[model samples]
Target: MADQTFDIEYVANLARLSLSDEEKQQLGSQLGQILDYIDQLNEVDVEGVEATAHPFPLVNVMRDDVIEGSLPHNEAMQNAPKKLNGLFQVPKIVE
Candidate 1:
């Protein structure tokens, strides 16, 4: 692990963030502490423990796909702010 403090300007540039000198110093110190904590975690022993993607058991509880009911087109169109030719008229997105 590198003991030297991380370059704040380099980190900020990588993140595309504009930080003041004060903010850069503060964030640099905070990031150093976080890196230190991660380094400490390397000391822990995890022998015999299986690496899992998730901490809890996951199961697919999704219900089977089924068609229950249908709504009339006019009824669905009633809530549209604007409509034209029996279809919703949205603002022009492309130039």
Candidate 2:
């Protein structure tokens, strides 16, 4: 795990970054730990396990779609900044 030292210098070179010696060592160690964890996960036995996007079962709780009357044209346009013939008016953006 800790035996694998991350090529922090190479990564920094690619990212156009300048890191101090201490920072490089610290980041390299952290990256090495992450790789070690991934290696450990790779060793896990999931022969009978099902592949899933999430650990828990997901369900969408939805309400029934009911038909309803819409607001009257006058009431709907009461707070509008601009209005045309029974429609909301907007600034013209195209010729």
Candidate 3:
């Protein structure tokens, strides 16, 4: 932050921007002010602080799987639209 200056023309070229003289002067002052605030932030001490990817701790949100008895074969086939022998009779899928 010591003796820093915003190179308006150079930055404009890097960003592929075409700025007028008035616009360049206005933007240069604005960029300088933004950098001044960042320079002030650099004065803060962050000793022994751990960096985190997220603000809160991530956890597995899935519920535990519960094993339960399945319906009997006769009960399962009871609601079938079509049944043959003891199983559901589905339409032919292959020619």
Candidate 4:
């Protein structure tokens, strides 16, 4: 993995972040450790292991969509702070 080295300053510049020297050093070490763990995982044997998007089987848990009743316009507009001509009114938003 070509040593998986990280450049904290370069990454911060790319992200448009301004970090103190201490913060840069700390984040660099932390990210380095995370990359080392990933490298270690790459060394494990995976012979005969099947590749999968998910570790376990998944199923759609959503219920089927169905037509539903809607509230009457007058009833739905009852709580409006302002209404004009059977519709809600608001301040102008754009020029």
Per-model TM-score versus the true fold: 0.44, 0.38, 0.44, 0.42
As a TM-score, model 4 comes out at: 0.42
**For model 4, how does the per-residue alpha-carbon lDDT over 1-95 read when each residue is reduced to its tens digit?**
62446777888999999999999888887888887777877788999988898878778878669878899999999999999999899999999
For residues 15-88, write the lDDT of model 2, one tens digit per residue: 99999999998988888878787787667899999899878866896778988899987998899888889788
User: Model 3 — TM-score against the truth?
Assistant: 0.44
Record all residue pairs in model 1 with backbone atoms less than 3 Å apart, i.e. clashing. Answer: none
Q: After superposition, which runs of candidate 1 have C-alpha atoms over 4 Å from their true positions?
A: 2-4, 7-17, 66-95
lDDT by residue (tens digit), candidate 1, 1-95: 84558788887899999999899888878888888878876787988879898789678868769987789889999999999988988889999
Q: Please list the C-alpha lDDT of all candidates, in the order they appear.
A: 0.84, 0.84, 0.83, 0.84
- Model 3 lDDT per residue over 42-69, tens place: 7789788788978897788787698888
Best-first order by TM-score: 3, 1, 4, 2
lDDT of 3 at 39: 82
- Count backbone overlaps in model 4: 0
Q: Which stretches of candidate 2 lie over 4 Å from their true place?
A: 1-3, 44-95
Better of 2 and 3 by lDDT: 2
- Comparing 1 and 4 by TM-score, which wins? 1
